[model samples]
Target: MHRRSAVTVAVAAALALLVATLTVLTGAYEITPGGVVSTLFGGGSGTDRFIVWEQRLPRAVAALLVGVALGGCGAVFQSVARNPLGSPDIVGFTTGAASGGLVMILVVGSAGSQSVLVGTVAGGALAAVTVVLFTLRRGLGGDRLVLSGIAVGAMLAALNDYLISRAPIEAAETAKAWQYGSLNAIGWRPVVPLAVSLALAVPVTLALARSLRALELGDDAAAGIGLGVTATRVTALAVGVFLAGAAIATAGPIGFLALAAPQLAGRLSRAPGIALGPSMAVGALLLAVADLLAQRLLSPFQIPVGLLTAAVGGAYLVWLLTRAPRREGARGAR
Candidate 1:
């Protein structure tokens, strides 16, 4: 299993690197691989500088960062929930962040991009807390928690629809592409906020990982082994929500990477539970590749990255659903 995981991690890293390279080279105004390398070192032609530095680089960075964030957040959520299905995308976290982003885009039209990110953070955190409060009766890591998240997410999605409907056309127009999660209009400015968010969330999550492993043994066993079950759960949830929200802030809640990446990583690595590092690598690869496709799939008429992810992820979700029961039955037999 260890050897398998190592190979999986290596392959995932290679894939991410390849996808990043290809995304940098692709667009309506395509740059050669040689040109992309030169542009990164500040030696490309003026057109390359404007398109590569000002346009594609930041978008690519945002896609990569958001993917990492979602991947890490998904692993944490799945661990906390003790279910493979527990992901920010399937739960309320993404919707909460989206709702907050929509409000910022529509209601606070005058506020800057910074405000939009803040709103996303607030929305995601609030939604996570709300889900916790409602499901605490049954406790975390239960089917009840998953169902509650689905419920809350549905409600927030409805609110998002209503908000979009009531907003001015201009504001709604801006929100429309965001609603589907696009990396079309990114820049260095947006990258700064997301960087800050990741810096804050990632280290904290890593520190809690040992505790998370302990908690997987169950509260009684974990506490007996010196883990602060309640505190660990809270910390994990906070970090997970923060990462998910920040990703949404940067890229408008691109879904399924969070839902799918960790599970895929776990399977590939033969992890008994979700593996964070491998998951992040897979997610970065997935979104970067997805973004690359989003730009070139329709060529000059680019579609939203979120739209493509949604279609693909919806199909993945269906597959997971059908596959889950058989896996569970096998485990039961074991």
Candidate 2:
């Protein structure tokens, strides 16, 4: 709770709120400003009620919560790995989860179902196991794990595309929407499981933040200080895998939020290392805005929010690579 961290949280909260408000106000079926307020409080025309309560409100809430989960886990992975590049996307969890959900969507033909969620989490777990098996050949090092994840992720990406190509035309189109990280088909029904999962995961991650700090001192130092290095790492890996799986299950691989949120949060909060609170808030802010942009950019034709974030993240990646100190490359790649 540094003052800078507090300030960053407040600012991100404000931006998230503003984005939510704008999202409600903007859409295909326009509702007047006063109408939106009245509708929110249980008094408006049927159209306004349906659009606001039944539609936009749930979508906005889902986006916010998903961002929170992604952002929180992003901080966990980055801090645990001791490098900013140590995110779920880079670690292969996202690709695994996506591959699972894609299979459900294409082969099983369940786009947004509880079964699809199960498949995703299961796929992600398997992918995580595979990466760990490969990396654990020598020892559990973040660099080795990341390298394994990248390779696994590339293979999974191909699998995902192949599945899509083999799908029926209609199913292909349906899976295509999910693949883009679009929230077009989401409703309040699916939000329950997602919200519940995030609620369960958040407190655990927050509790582990202190252990993460100690672990940042390296395994020997952490163990000397009486922290259970193995258990801590295992718990963190579980948390990151679960978070990334839930996110992918809900939104289908919304890239770069995991990659960018923690680093940006660290800079904004002026944290000694990485901070989870600011990262969650920043993630909510980024997603809220991205979802808004996704709706507005194509107007009648909504683009996927993932596309927008990927574009933004790509630019940020370029800046990061260019601005990073040369010596850090060896350390980061490790």
Candidate 3:
């Protein structure tokens, strides 16, 4: 198992590197990998150097950071919720974060990164807390919790739409870009906060990986083995919120990567529980690939990265619903 795990990690790392390379090399003014490397290292023509270093590099880095944050957060949530269906995308955390972002952009007229990050974190954290509090009475188990999360997500989405409707035409147009998610206007400005947040949160996530494993057991069983169920759940939720909020702040709630990456990692790892390392890797790879497609698919008129992810993620969700087993638990939790 250790050897297999190591091999999986190696393969994921290689894939992430390959995807990053492709993203850098396949843009409009193509450059060889060596040229890309030299341009990044300050040894190329003015335009080539500027495009490589100033334009694409930051976007690539943003994609990688967003991927890691989403993937890691997804694994944490899925484990704590003890449902394969549990994810920010499924439970309304992403929607809440996006709503928070829209509020900052439309109502407050603040498009600053810190303002958006603060609002997004607050929104996502509140949503997570609400989900846990409302669903805990009958115990967090199976499809009931997932169903409640879905309902909350839908409500938050409706709220998002209402806010969009009330805004002025200009604000509404700006919010539309956010709603679909995009990496176009992003630069190094937003990257700093996301890097800091990920630096702090990633360590916490790795340290808690074992606890997340225990969480996959029911709360009672986890408590029996000396885990503080409430504390662990809250800590994990906080990490997830931080990650989702940061990603939304930086990249405008890129859809489905968070939901799909962790599940894909778990399957690839063949682990009984969530796999954080692999999930982060897969998430990074997915975003890199998605961004590559978004940039190249329409030439001068690029598609929003969020739209590409949603299309892929939405299709994956449909496939999941068809494959998911019917639950035998109580319909709604008290």
lDDT (CA) per prediction: 0.85, 0.84, 0.85
- Clashes in each model (backbone N, CA, C under 3 Å)? 1, 1, 0
Off by over 4 Å in 1: 1-7, 331-334
**What TM-score does candidate 3 get on C-alpha atoms?**
0.93
Cα-based TM-score, every candidate: 0.94, 0.94, 0.93
Q: Summarize candidate 3's per-residue lDDT along 1-334 as a digit string, tens digits.
A: 3455456667886888788777777688867778888887778899888788777888888988899999999888788778777888888888889888888898899999999999899889877777777788876556766787788889999999999899999889889877888998578899999999999999999889888788787777889999998888778889889999999999998988988998888778887666888888889989988998999899877899999999999999889887654333333332
lDDT of 2 by residue, 1-334 (tens): 7789889999998899899888987788867888899889998988889889888998898788888888988898887767677788888888898899988888877766577778888888888889878977654556787788889989999999999999989899878888788776578877888899888988898889889888888889899999998788778888888888888777778998888988898988997756888999999999998998889888878888899989999888788878768657778988
Between the candidate structures 1 and 2, which one is better when assessed by lDDT?
A: 1
lDDT tens digits, residue span 1-334, model 1? 2577678878987887778767778778877878888888999889999998888888888888888898899999999999878898877888998999888888877436688888988899999999999888767776777889999999999999999999888888778878788898689887898898888888887777678878888889999988878788888998898898788878887988898888888888886544777787788888988998998888898889999999999999999999999998999999
lDDT of 2 at 63: 86
Residue 200 miss distance in model 3 (angstroms): 0.3
State the weakest 10-residue window (summed lDDT) of model 1.
1-10
